[model samples]
Target: MREAYHDQLDSIFDDLAGICRRVETAVSLATHALMNGDAAVAERVISGDVEIDVAREQVEETAFDLLTLQQPVATDLRTIVAALRMVSELERMGDLSVHVAKVARLRVPDVAVPDEIRPTIERMAAVAEDMVGRVCEVIISRDVEAAIALGRDDEEMDGLRRRSFAELLSDDWTHGVEAAVDVALLGRYYERIADHAVSIANRVIFVVTGHHPAALAEQ
Candidate 1:
């Protein structure tokens, strides 16, 4: 019975990994949809959110089952708890991708993305992508060191998020208020995504190493 339960735990882990990959694709599509102004791609990202939602529910079910069936202890207990927490973050990331797609759909014509903030938004997208990628890697390999490294990378994302907001409110962006609003919203989304990614990493560290990583001063 213990052997059967262990197999069940492993299977749930695999399912969680698939959830990560799907979300990564959703985010990438959302980024391209934003950059190209492709209505089809924006629609695709929005539809993809349904899949993320399904995955989130499935994961929650599996985690709850494992807790009751296996009655996991110590590290094993942490594994189920961590998986549950990570799924919440992953689902939110998917929702943010959908939000970006919605914003893209709204800004198809007038109010082109201003010249000043495009690069910053692009950087934020890249950071969001990288954070999701690294978090998945940390989960797949159970590498605490890699998770720590990703946490550091999140700092750069925070810096970019902050600059994007500052530029939006400053006189530097006088021409496009609507575009400024989009940039501000998109920046906040990416920043939140990055935060969730870092949380997943920290949870993994706790699962494997039995402790949380150092808290970065949240600005």
Candidate 2:
């Protein structure tokens, strides 16, 4: 009975990991679309959302089945629960990427942005991608140290969002109201994507070490 339960636990995590991969693919496609204004790529990102959604549902079902079948205890229970919560976070991250692509499509039709902002956008996207990727790494390896650094990466995303927000709100923002709004929305989406990654990292911390990030800090 124990061996059977262990297999279920491993199987659930295998499906959860696939959810992370789908998010990374969508994010990369969306970032390219944002940077190069590729409608074809944007459409691909938008369409690929279907895969993320399907993976999310599969993860949830697997977790629930494990809970019903195994009634996991201790670390096993914690891991399954964390997977359930983290999968939702990952799914929302994919949606944020789609939002960025939509905003990118809007911007490309109107005018070209200055090169300075492009690099910043690219950096933000890169950090966001790393955050999602690292969380999956931590999950697969059960490495608490790897999860810990995700907070620092998230701070970088926060900084990028703040800088872009200030630029858009500044009096010198000559992009007009429509473009300015699009930029702000895209920045917010990236920021939130980072936030979701942070959430998953915390979940990994809890699952691997049995202590939440908040608990660790209080200690």
> Across residues 55-126, which tens digit of lDDT does each residue of candidate 2 receive?
889878878888897777888888888888888888899899889877767667433344556677778889
- Top-lDDT structure, candidate number: 1
lDDT per residue as tens, model 1, 40-132: 888999987998899889989888988987788987888888888888888998999999888887876433357677898888899899889
For candidate 2, the 10 contiguous residues with the lowest summed lDDT are 107-116
Query: Relative to the true structure, how large is the alpha-carbon lDDT of every model?
Result: 0.83, 0.79
Those runs of model 1 whose alpha carbons end farther than 4 Å from true positions after fitting are: 110-112, 216-219
TM-scores, each model vs. reference: 0.93, 0.91
Residue 46 of model 1: what lDDT? 94
The local distance difference test score of model 1 is 0.83
Model 1's number of clashes is: 0
Top TM-score prediction, candidate number: 1
lDDT of 2 at 213: 93
Instruction: Compute the lDDT of residue 58 as modeled in candidate 2.
Output: 81
What is model 1's C-alpha RMSD?
Answer: 1.8
